[model samples]
Target: MLTKKLNRFNTLRNQILTVFLFVMTVVLLFVGVTTFHVVSTLLKNNAEEQIEQTVTQANGRLEALYKQLDGLTNQITTNMYVQQMLLKEVNGDYLGFRERQNLQQLVNSFQTYSDGIQSFELYTSNYKRVFPLDEIDLVNRLGIHWVKQAEEAKGKMVWIGRDPKSPHFFVVLRQIRLMDRWFSPGGYLLVRINPEYFQFTDFITSKTKKQGYMLVADRDLTPIFSNFVGDSKEILHAQQRTVQQNGEEYIVVKQTSPLTGWVLMIVTPVSALTDGVAILKNTILFSGAIGFLIFFIFSLFLSTMVTQPILKLTKAMQRGKDGELRPSPPISSTVEINELNDTYNALVENINHLIQVVYEKELVRSRAELKALQAQINPHFLFNTLDALYWSLVEKEEEELAQVVLNMSELFRYTVSNSKQDEWVTLYEEIEHIRRYMEIMKLRWGDRLLWNIVIPASCFDIRIPKLLIQPLVENAVLHGIGNKTDLGIVWVTVEDCHESSDIVIKVADDGYGMDEQTKEKVNELLNNKEVSSAKGSGMALVNVNKRLQLYYGEERKLVIHSELGQGTVVLLKIPKSGEE
Candidate 1:
């Protein structure tokens, strides 16, 4: 559960917020850590300087004590009465009562000028000791070793340490020289000085003591006394600096006391120096978290501000695809989003305008062409029928004229009726209308316009557009039969193409057909080879051809086969599908 809550997703808002928070966190951490480090470093340096001062002051006090002790030793060695007593003791002569009393008075006088001196006594050349003894080292030979080192110094002081029997202390040995002979030693003086005698640890205050530790080492880098957690030799050997012992880091600074020859080293732990920065770390982390939260919220707002407009534009595009080609409503957003909306609205409006202008224009044009063709057929047929009736009346044939009038009335009613606006009629009805049309033309041309029609029973109920066939029959009667002088025959053949699921109709004439050039021109116009530019003989066939293609689709082609002396057949292939 905690892991899931800590996980960040790849949503736009999250991405934006993450980037902003990352940059902000980096900058804040950089600044905060840098400030903490710099302050911690400054504190360390200041503490180091203070520690060095304390060690220097401690060394000065020790140097003063050394001078005082040296003066006291000079006084005791140079005194005429004290030297006589020491000579009497070294020669094994018994000391007189008055002489011992004078020597004790001299020792009391030396003790009055010195402080923190555990002992101040002289030892004779015969190994007779006068100072305090930590137990006689006759079995260990340590006392003999100190005496031998003191004799080697001749007249100088030798500060010595490493007495296994002693507790945190050292000895100062000086060979007692004779007054008469400068290099001749009468005996040696011993001073066992406690490290706490001068109270050097008191130099470190309570606050600074918590910061680090202090150590005192001998001239050969051997630690005599140390508060550091390491072996005496380990502390002394790490004199240069930067020692890691017990997983704790320390900075070592050393100052050697000239008189005492002790290395006073301040071992300041590095971790202790930066202890004050913990508060700073907590403060920076708290403030950074608050800042990151605020930035994340701001990023979310910004992400929504950018994405909402795009979502709206996407919805508008979806509406356009759904056929709602209308302009979008006003939107309040950035400039780019507003521009995109405006452009999209404009595109939809342009599409709607094109639909209105182009598609409606095409519909109006098709209707006009159909009506014009119908009008042309009606008037031409009426004039020709009237002329044929006039000729019958001139011959005084009442019955034939009356019969022609009735047929023409029925044909006009079929073609011009306003009851059916869609002009749909079954194939049987269309064939009957063609029969009546041919009968009137046969009356007008007599034997020159004989006609025959072949229509199948199965094709009788198939519906087709009205007046789609009459014009072809009329064209064969007037052009092919009227142009010949002998008896002409018009053949109308209709067959159901079962395999192709279509109805094939042919209107042929046995009269003389046109020349090769004329036939080519007529067929070109009928086939619509020149689009809407052809003008001449096959206008009626062209009218039927266009209506066929417009009602049934463009694949319906009006095929024509003609020969100069043989006759012409116009083959119309129409689909068997219903039309209304």
Candidate 2:
């Protein structure tokens, strides 16, 4: 009898121990996952915030550098010796050897005032000259010809090219015109600036110790100065090839000088700016893991105390499954476990209610997604209609009819090709779609519809959104010229608006145009306002307007100008291609 009692006691203890280990493992796992996720998110956000702050500091430093350079250029332009050289009379003729020596003395005096200047040269339209000693023979020996460019530039300041005298310098040529005639031929003032003057290392040396690099690139993405020395040609090429790069996140601040034609680029590496945040993330992860391990060990000890009474109750519940409602065990270690037991029983009673709620929510979400998919069916329907029309014309042995159908089919294909979300199509693709649309219209209306598309070759490769222009053209045919009695003329033109920094597309039609009331209705729709019930169908125009506003902003919306008898002209002011 004693041995049997001992065996039952040991069996009960082993069951309690197993339940304790299982509960502790579950609690520790939940804590670990929750801690890790919360800490990781916080670390990432802090890192990004820190990086933004560093970028702001770097931008400030670069702006200061730009200001300093501008001041330096102004100083050189106003130097007394430079002014004296500008005042000298050349009479459109070559300077004597003695006169060249005097000009060299002036250049040397100006060079003494600024250490950044590597060299200076003077050249006239009639004769090429060098300063600080006549090096015309040497210039001829080296085959350096900058005199032609000075004449081409006339009286304006121009960056001729990379310096032939010294590869490390960039030559700035300021043509000096005579004050009396202004047309009288004058000499050129050539100033060579050392590349090291713009190098960021002189000011950003302290930041480099904290993991930062500053670099300056020209408008062509040619590296003018860099913190590290080597051939940066490949990096410069990569920067020019794409607006952004993979595996490298950088912030580029550009300062363009109208006076100098120089595009100063300030580049800050993201890694240097966010290194502190990376360290913080690693620290948090390490500490959280250590905390989880300690909590796991502590929970194991605590579970041993809590699971004894629960094990007894669990076994009683198992017995109840066989139709015996035995009472639970008496006397637990803590009130929390007793409360947990009560909660679990309540949850079991209402499990069906929770399941019903989850199922209903999921069903509602699925129905919403189905409705969204249903709304996208119109484009597919239109494409199918065009395909059917094409095949029907082909079967009837009508060549012109078949060609028109095919063109319409191609137009719809281009419109529905939305596989790429951020795809930038060439201007040529846009023109091709317009051509297909016009061909279809010509076949439908015969000689009644007249169209002229004038697009320059320079605008062909510019990137625009796919199907951007065709929609307006379609609207013109469907609404503007569809009801016109006499021959209708539609003119489409693409031109560069350099002053506005954009490409202007003008679509003008000499057909029956809208009155003031109808024009106001169209304007309301373009502004995303609801039209009055009396106003007619404007769905296509509204859709086009919304899409343009979505892709670009309100500033890039379509501008309409029209009169009752003067017809209508639609002007689209889209940003130039390759802009950020």
Best by lDDT: 1
Best by TM-score: 1
In model 1, which runs have C-alpha deviations exceeding 4 angstroms? 1-15, 18-95, 98-102, 105-115, 124-145, 162-169, 178-187, 202-211, 220-222, 237-261, 267-281, 318-335, 355-580
Q: Any runs in candidate 2 off by more than 4 Å, and if so which? A: 1-88, 92-105, 135-154, 180-185, 202-210, 229-231, 239-278, 308-580
Which pairs of residues collide in candidate 1?
A: none
Model 1 C-alpha lDDT per residue in residues 108-175, reported as the tens digit of each score: 67766666565565566655554333233322424667677878888677776654457555667677
RMSD vs true structure, all candidates = 12.5, 48.0
- Backbone collision count in every prediction? 0, 0
TM-scores of all candidate predictions against the true structure: 0.51, 0.41
| lDDT of each residue in 1-580, candidate 2, tens digit only | 9999877767544555556556656665676667656765665456445444544555565556555544554454455554445445454344556766875775566667555677766655344564545447423522345555555766555554467657778766665665554555555566777876565554444544444445556555655666633334544444442234456655433444444434444345556545665666676668667866676566556655666767766876786577555455444567876776665566544554444445543453354346445544787787788788878888898878888878877776665454444346888888898999899888878899999999888788888876667777877887788878888888889988767778889888887788999899888877753322232456556655654654565455788888897788888877776333
